[model samples]
Target: MDTEALRWFQLVCDGMTVTEVAHVHQVSQPAVSRSLARLEAEVGTPLLQKAGRLLRPTYAGAVFKRHVDALIHRLDDGLAALTELTDPRTGTVAVAFQLSLGTFLVPGMIESFREEYPRVRFRLEQSHDALGSSMVAGGRIDLEFTSRRPRNPAVRWERLFAQPLFLAVPRRHRLARRREVSLADAAEEDFVMLRPSWELRTLSEQLCADAGFEPRVAFEVDDLPVVHGFVAAGLGVAIVPATEGEPQPVGAAAALVRLTDAGAFRDIGVAWSRERRLLPSAELFRRHVLALKGGRMPTATA
Candidate 1:
């Protein structure tokens, strides 16, 4: 429990002889042994046991050292984060969003933001589209990118642009040959879907319901890449947004069919708390992203 005793114990674990630990601490060998004995007494167990004339840590001593080391490291990190928070140019940005948004939005935003504030640090938290909105509302995140505008009055949404969904199928599949596929035609086949709670999942379900039937969900996953992977593997077809760099052609494995009949598009936008004004770094980031000549993100709503 004593700090000095803990330090001596660490030295012992590092292979310091009791005589050497005593010498470093400017104490006698008896003093070192008494400190170790007192520590063992307080802990109700022997932290070290005699191995011939040398001492070695017992199992409990090894575990305790690991715990102490981790605690000390975390304390150091906590202090560093506190210091970072007080400096605008060097603060941490906690931005949360869905993976699709990360692929489409964060890269551009980060590149521009870093150009102006090279010292700014970031902590990204990615979740499903639906979950990102909730994170902003719950005060667990600083900013969020969501496909659907938040309905909760506690948060504010700014409509950036529509990310239209498209049908993706293996290139060799019959539907892949179409110039643009209708949802009705594609709905008849097996489909890989996002989980029902996701914004994309809810939208996909609604689009299929409008066509007069629920999609026969052949496989469901939260990750969009996995959806693409499934389509590439010939497991089932899927619907995904036409992200600018998307459908990274899987070696004749998949093709994208713009779904004209689905008549559905996810509104992509940024959201933050209505009660809080934008921080300087956040405002800088917003202005940079919106200033692009043809970029979708626009000014925040009033």
Candidate 2:
């Protein structure tokens, strides 16, 4: 398995003809074919077979390509990391955060960080809340800004702060005028809940149970904002996080009543793999986040 043969084979698997590959590589068609043959011989199988006028990978070739694709991806990441290691200013930090935190929470932190490290690069992903722990543990990302605690042994979660949760009701609802209310007060109301897989869904359910009644779920949704929308539409009440200062009609439409329950806040945290060391840029960003413990995230203007 020569590297040149592997590259040529990969291109063919991507539907390149031998002539086209030769044209791209500025090599003779015979040269490309010879490379493919040697590659197949090394693997003890025909990697490509004629399908009419076109060439396609055999089942074994396709499986080999899958692993090759992963290897190539890891290789690219390694090269990038090597370059970054020599030049810390150009290092990239990979981050995964909850969609709920994207609007301002995560963005604000990133904005502030860039102020100090303007040339540092970042790769960001918006992940579902429940996926944070698993993503970090699996090495899919360097760090995750999440509200849920990681249950995996290889992952560590450090609480940055506790964000207060609220009971959101339609603006015209009778209880909207109150500054605070107990979970039991909403016991008889229809609930708009996030899907069962969401940790917030489970937390809301447990809160209701502690209040001595089960929530009669009227709507099931996929995300936090949708739950807010459903609650604002008067479909049902919901448990929601406090809105940022940014003007959101959805926030304005849904009157937030502070929950009187003892545990009405969720711990906001950054999670990372304990089994793996962080890259230089990632470690810097993690330290920056830790420095902000119990402080508000700096806005874009700041």
Candidate 3:
């Protein structure tokens, strides 16, 4: 069961004399012999035998060596991988981001990071949780590029920037020609919205309230693009983000108008679990992402 015994048995089987193996290991020949004896005893077979003058493995030892070789090889590889994971420039980082940011913001940041740390590998994850991403708190991810700042104390958030929210309406709509409009101006219009669980939906509702009118809900969808599509189809109007970091593309059927109201922009940032220590690679990548902000403070309408 001792690894040293198995190793000695393997070496002896590989044609090394007990004396030679002991000399190489700086032990007595009897020590090597004892190790071989214990190994054969444990395996319940004579693994090594004297063939004329050279020491060699028996058929059973030859068969067992293959399994031992594989085990040792895997163990060594695992140790190396663990060591590599701590190397800042050559380690792996696991990153998670909201689905909306995947189009531009998150990917652009990752691409820029890889340019500097080409040797570093990344594991990417995407989440659509509308109530604020919880992957960090659960330690499922090292960092998350998200729009809503997490409310969990276990998760730390950094304000990167704000994505300005825009009102998208059909090109033929009365307010479509306007470059900018008040949320109150469209209060009576039927609204195309993401599900109520979505953060943007919550924001739209609050902004509508501040504007002194509740948006009449009409169509509900799961994704921003779909919400935009509904607006373009004249199903209803929807609030969307634009002219900012990786804003979703608006189709020609829909026109985006800037909103003139308090808190019209959503804060986009990164979240990480404070309870877990990030590997050197991930920590460095986090720094790289933060630096991308270029000292820009988040803007809020309210």
Candidate 4:
């Protein structure tokens, strides 16, 4: 049905003569009358009745007017919401990141962003690099922080910085006091690491390969905290990001030894689908991350 004709029918029902509605709308009276006629034909009923000099809506017209009023109100609201989403100061940014970054990096960034954009809101999702990359490609997330660059052609990956990888061992371990250690140094030691599906695990394996040894897998876990707990309990040592291996306590529950091997770093960056257009807020957040200074890798002390 024609929305404009329905609107004209509603105006005629509001105690305005057909000629008056035409005058208000700057259209001919016959044009207005034909619109109402089309509306009545479309609904297969009489929508208005001539009551003396004024036109009043019939029962069917009143019912149709209610539905039209609701549809128009919803359309107006949708347009307003679109305007707000495109507004730089009021839009919402949806972000996805690896679970490890949620501990410190993402939260700190969000807090700083909020300081600058108090009215903007955020929707955050935590997943592994693979899944986070998929979310960005599928347009489920506007932006993603991930260690692995997405291989999909439709997604764009911007390398923010490389985070140094560290060897996490129990506090009392002999190498814990060492300022730097090679992966080959722990070749014989049992290794606790994330599942192979995680990008960090692949990076760690490659690092071990570069160090000239295959690490004996002792435990396979998905959670970062669990990996840390197993290492702290002396089960085995694991190569983890500097941020993840940083000592949380003053004395250190586990010691983070710097890897002496060359190219011992994981590249982290923001990813988004080129096919999707980011909201103003998401674009601003992306710029904020790209503009961040050094310290992508937290310093680990022996």
| Each model's lDDT | 0.76, 0.84, 0.82, 0.82
User: 220 in model 3: Cα distance from truth in Å?
Assistant: 1.3
TM-score of each: 0.64, 0.70, 0.84, 0.82
Kindly report which residue stretches of model 3 are placed more than 4 angstroms away from their true locations once superposed: 1-8, 16-46, 245-247, 250-252, 294-302
204-246: candidate 2 lDDT, tens digit per residue: 8998998999999999999888887888889999998764553
Deviation of model 1 at 256, angstroms:
1.4
**Clashes per candidate (backbone, < 3 Å):** 0, 0, 2, 0
Please provide, for model 1 over 59-86, each residue's C-alpha lDDT reduced to its tens digit, 9 standing for 90 to 100: 9988888976776677668889777775
**Ranking 1 against 3 by lDDT, winner:** 3
The prediction achieving the highest lDDT against the true structure is: 2
Candidate 4 residues lying further than 4 Å off, grouped into runs, are 4-38, 51-54, 130-133, 244-252, 293-302
Q: What is the lDDT of candidate 2?
A: 0.84
The predicted structure with the larger TM-score, 1 or 3, is 3
RMSD of each: 10.4, 10.6, 4.4, 4.3
Better of 1 and 4 by TM-score: 4
Better of 2 and 3 by lDDT: 2
Assess the local accuracy of residue 5 in candidate 4 as a C-alpha lDDT between 0 and 100: 84
**What C-alpha root-mean-square deviation, in Å, does candidate 4 show against the real structure?**
4.3
| Residue range with the least summed lDDT across 10 consecutive positions in model 1 | 293-302
